[model samples]
Target: MTDDPAATFARARAAAGVLFFNDNDQIMLVDPSYKDYRDVPGGYLERGETPRQAAEREVAEELGIHPELGRLLVADWAPSEAEGDKVLFLFDGGTLTKDHLDGIRLDPGELVGFQFHDIAHVHDLTISRLARRLVHAHAAHLDGSTRYLEHGEWI
Candidate 1:
């Protein structure tokens, strides 16, 4: 993908990510059979659903738990090869226990494995930049610190 920020943002589509946080403060990542790497549980937002509502529905469908999402942690405009002009919304999912995870039911076509990973290690994984920003914003929120908001940064 081109790193030209303007071009990328101009083509970004609308999407959402379900920010799943565990009791240990880690976020949940899903490994899809189609991709070698894992990513946050989410997909393109359906018509008539808000980002927050989409996040809640996605987590419940993928992991079978209704998560209490926090205020918007990260919102970014990104571009994708398969789908362009992707606007990603990432929310802070509160703590979840093993009991909660046990309720998850994987969607065979989209997900294969799942894990609760540390926020710091998130950058090391081969994930979308939007995902990284979401995790960073989440970590910042958790530490009670301020973070720069890149509103319309590329648009």
Candidate 2:
């Protein structure tokens, strides 16, 4: 039997991020220095890395804080026009204690700024698909369960 690399290769790209909240029920979002839209702290997964690992690592690289990420909040399948097919993962970053905030040291070259906002502002602050994804993720976090989404819609 012969193994075909074409059939075994990854068809979709994967990325992971974390959803952090505050006591007042706000979502933390970051403004990337290179992108126009605001987004959560994360990046694409490295080879052989799991989603959870990627989330934890990305947060540390971008925010300069090593937060304990919990179970996944959502795994979304979103295909972008520019990126083709992709699978996005979101993990629970839990509520930020004062220490978490105090520890933040944004990488100026990658992230310009970051802020917390009411859930309602997600639509206005992020890209359309990500806005939907975050809205669902925030809700899932409050409910203590993970969500399965397709381009941000509950599936």
Candidate 3:
């Protein structure tokens, strides 16, 4: 143990994202320029920002849209060798109207494009852990509940 109690704790990186669905119940995913796979509209939480605020800010910065986000859907504790430990939060973006969809303006510096995909194909498009998180987040949204997951699986 360390002399200072705070030094004994691990500092996990945290990120916040939103789950958006279209009228067809398809999930909206963004192709990030920095990553090989698609992801939801969100990014890491800045210092002095709440998870929800980070989510909202990321959406505006990445997509240039300001849709109201709903309740928390899923929170996952995922540890990665490359990224160290991480805590991820997913919020409900509700169903996007045509107008909301039309207003999307992708930030070319961060994202390439955005697409809507069938929920069944999520695993094919992203990493397994992220796919699991999306699946559980969608279920939580449908049932109006929240979920806690470890590495994207319920304990």
Clashes of each: 8, 0, 0
Instruction: Report the candidate with higher lDDT, 1 versus 2.
Output: 2
Ranking by TM-score: 3, 2, 1
Q: Which residues of candidate 3, in runs, are more than 4 Å off?
A: none
> Model 1 off-target regions past 4 Å?
1-12, 128-131, 144-155
Candidate of highest TM-score: 3
Q: Please, what are the lDDT tens digits per residue for candidate 1 over residues 14-115?
A: 666666677777777888878787787777778888888888888777666775777766677555566655677777666776677777789887788888
Candidate 2: tens digits of C-alpha lDDT, residues 31-120: 999999999999999999998889988999999999788889999999888998899999989899899999999999899999999999
All candidates: CA RMSD (Å): 6.0, 2.3, 0.8
Q: Evaluate model 3: give its TM-score.
A: 0.97
Collision count of model 3: 0
- Per-prediction TM-score: 0.76, 0.93, 0.97
Native-to-model Cα distance after best TM-score fit, residue 13 in candidate 2, in Å: 0.7
lDDT digits (tens) for residues 39-150 of candidate 3: 9999999999999999999999999999999999999999899999999999999999889888999999999999999999999999999999999998998898999999
